[model samples]
Target: MPSSPPNPQLAKRYISYTVDDIARLFGIHRHTVREWIKRGLPVIDKQRPLLVQGADLAEFLRKRRDARKQSCAPGQLFCLRCRVPREPAGWQVVYRPLTATQGTLNGLCGTCSARMCRRVSLAKLTAAAGNLAITTTQAGEHIDECPTPIVNRDFKEG
Candidate 1:
């Protein structure tokens, strides 16, 4: 999905909208607006047309955009397969420099064993490396390390 434009002024122009109105304004199908309603878009359902308040829609969209903008903490990477932020299993992280100031942190998800990666600033990574067992490598270098065994006892086998 394309990222939403960071325009707060556009959201303030309307007080309320119908599904058709929203679809027309956003250049999307009416069915897509209905789908958004199904996915927790607030609506005033007391009347026949089903009104969506502008303030409610703005808040919903802002929260959705913010969730997509989430960044991992210093010791975590986002696990694509698990769809959550996770720490590398056993602190076995690999850092590969992408540029002078940026790099990628690669590791395995502690729970699912899926490859997890996050882009990080080189300065922040260097600070984090002081406390974690991280292997540093040049840009584009592939590490052939096996997945570490899960150490968190709270994780259950599926």
Candidate 2:
């Protein structure tokens, strides 16, 4: 699930928080808060209960959340299955306009063969096409087509 934007009001109200306070504030398990501490969340440890400063925690969370965001260059699209930006297998992509200004770029992942797509502005399409070979089509032209069939891999339970 995606996280909501940080609340400036709440961040300004509290100077510090305990593990339990952080857990309750985010409606998450206390173990998750402890995990955050292990993940480099700064804390004040001189007292009996470790305290996480509001500014530190905010910055930590912000950085962590931002780290997950991936951007695609002109010739690339983000593959949901692989969770990375990848070029199309043949350096070719299909564009389907969603609106006057926005559209979707579709392609096959060069590595994993997953169907990949990324939303982009129409203004950028020309620059993106210059970087790669692109075929523009109507919305319903090739919605059902896939360059490669998806293979399901079974994982063994630990």
Best TM-score among the predictions, by candidate number: 2
- Summarize candidate 1's per-residue lDDT along 1-158 as a digit string, tens digits: 22343333445536788888776666556766676687688897768698898888788667655655666766877775664678888878898877799777788889899888777788788565445578889765665332222211112211
lDDT of 2 by residue, 1-158 (tens): 21453332344335889988876676566776776697688887768598988888888766645544656777887775665678888998888877778787888889899888877789888776557788888875647333211211101110
RMSD of 2: 10.2
Q: Give all candidates' CA lDDT scores.
A: 0.67, 0.68
Q: Model 1: which residue pairs collide?
A: none
Candidate 1 Cα lDDT to native: 0.67
Native-to-model Cα distance after best TM-score fit, residue 50 in candidate 1, in Å: 22
Which regions in candidate 2 have their CA more than 4 angstroms from the true location?
5-67, 142-158
TM-score of each: 0.49, 0.51
Name the 10 consecutive residues with the lowest summed lDDT in model 1: 149-158
Q: What would you estimate as the lDDT of candidate 2?
A: 0.68
